[model samples]
Target: MKTSDFHYDLPQELIAQAPLPERSASRLLHVPPGDACFADLHVRDLPSLLRAGDLLVFNDTKVIPARLFGAKATGGRVEILIERLLPGNEARAQLGVSKPPQPGSRIALDAGGEAEVLARFDDGFWQLRFQVEGPLEAWLQHAGQLPLPPYIERRPDAADAERYQTVFARETGAVAAPTAGLHFDEPLLAALRERGVQTGHVTLHVGAGTFQPVRVDDVHNHRMHSEWINVGAELVSQVRRTRAAGGRVIAVGTTVVRALESALVDGELRPFAGDTSIFIFPGYRIRSIDALMTNFHLPESTLLMLVSAFAGKQRMFAAYEHAVRERYRFFSYGDAMLLWPGEGESGSGDLR
Candidate 1:
């Protein structure tokens, strides 16, 4: 498939600039399998939409304040977005400046700290060794701003520090929040629990590259960004037990879908802990998740392609049209969708 295969028209005003007053207040577009039609619902209605024995897998990766502003010794301004933190006090980052800093150049941080540019990584990330007073994460927590997506017009404010994170967020590493999980609050989770729906968690620290556009026309030529994922043995067993008892494993976000599918080895789900660059496009076989609950995505994006792969391409496009016609919000801090695998798709069959 071509990258253009996923393109759709979205008005600039429809892109969500800020989060709603309440997380569960966002709209939900439920697209069932083998149908072009969809049902309009809200995030709080998820409990009624799903069955009692259904299991929801959520991404527990927490979004960190990764945006930083600093300056070179020559007073040249520089912006840094930490992509991944490495061992030995090193970090992989994207540095924005009038000119790329050379190796050995030091960048003076805002909070009376500095970092020396070590080298560049294979994937175009700059390696830096910080000389901060405390740990880099701690320093960032104090000085950095939340890394909001480009679509959001305004700057990150105090509300983003709490609203951008999910209720279950614990492991702090992601530069971007899993927007689908953002729709779930304590009340919503409690409702699901009371309805007898089981819940589990996996961690996939989403990187800044998630917003990178597809530069190539051929979908197969695009390369996915690497993100750290951990699908524990307990979750794997939970999924197996759910399947045995005739329950569906529903993924809360695309990150969870990728994490669970990447953990599949030899046609069965297993525990996995490592970085993955698994790219799911149309025609690709999905093995782990049964349904997906996710936010509407950007046009021609890898995320859209993954949804097209899970659901049928034509149906997914039609659903997007419906969302546009009804003026549903788009992108992060936007409305969500409950999607089931279409008939004849890889994830449509029963695991048992």
Candidate 2:
């Protein structure tokens, strides 16, 4: 399908500049599975909306401060946005410099460190190895700034230190947060546990490519940038039990959906760990997830395409228009929607 099929007119003011005072204070648009429907609600009303048997699958991949300012040895200032970490201390990063830095050169970051360009990979990324006093991951946690989406104009403030991440964040790696998980706080998790709504976590370190715009006019031609995902025995058991009990397996975000779906093959969801470049477009089959709670996505984006696959292109776009018409905030630091799979792509669809 054409990327334009997913487009909508969003008022500039609807783009959220900041998070709400309370994590669960954001609005929630409920898109039911039918031609005759949609309802607006609050995030706080989630507990009552769920049943005891329903499982809320969340992505626990923590966002790293991946965006950094640096200078090449040639004295040109550059910005490094870490995309994926290759094995053995090497990382694939996007170099935003006056001119792209050459291979095997030393570039010093403003926060205090230098990285040696190892080699250039396919496409725009360069593989660079950082010289660190401590582990590279720990250094990023302290020195880097939150990798907020480009649409968010201001530099990340102290409040963003907490608000941009979810309460359950662990297994540090994502450059971007799994936004649908952003709505839940400690109290909300406690509430879910108290209500017998099962909760399980998997890691899918969201990459900077998550917000990368889809350049293809034909959305299906776009290839997804690979990202790491892991679904363990616990989540599998929970999903199996949830299904056995006739309960819903609600995915928290597109990240969680990819993590679960990437592990699925041959009619079974195997525990998996590796990079997944799975681009879920329209007509793709969904095996495990029954519902989704996600933030509004950018038009003509792979993320938008994924949502369109879950909910139909028409329904999802209509819901997006509704959000815009109702002034629902947009993107990562924005309001969310709880989408029951559209009537055309509901439960028991093929995984492969």
The prediction achieving the highest lDDT against the true structure is: 1
- Candidate 2 stretches with Cα past 4 Å from truth are 346-352
Model 2 per-residue lDDT tens digits across residues 295-316: 9988777788788888887889
Off by over 4 Å in 1: 346-352
**What TM-scores do the predictions have?**
0.97, 0.95
- Candidate lDDT (C-alpha), each: 0.90, 0.85
lDDT of 1 by residue, 120-229 (tens): 87667898998887788887888889999988988999999999999899998999999999999999999999999999999999998898899999877787888999
Q: Ten-residue segment with the worst summed lDDT in candidate 2?
A: 343-352
Q: What TM-score does candidate 1 reach? A: 0.97
Model 2 TM-score?
0.95
RMSD of each: 2.8, 2.0
Best candidate per TM-score, number? 1
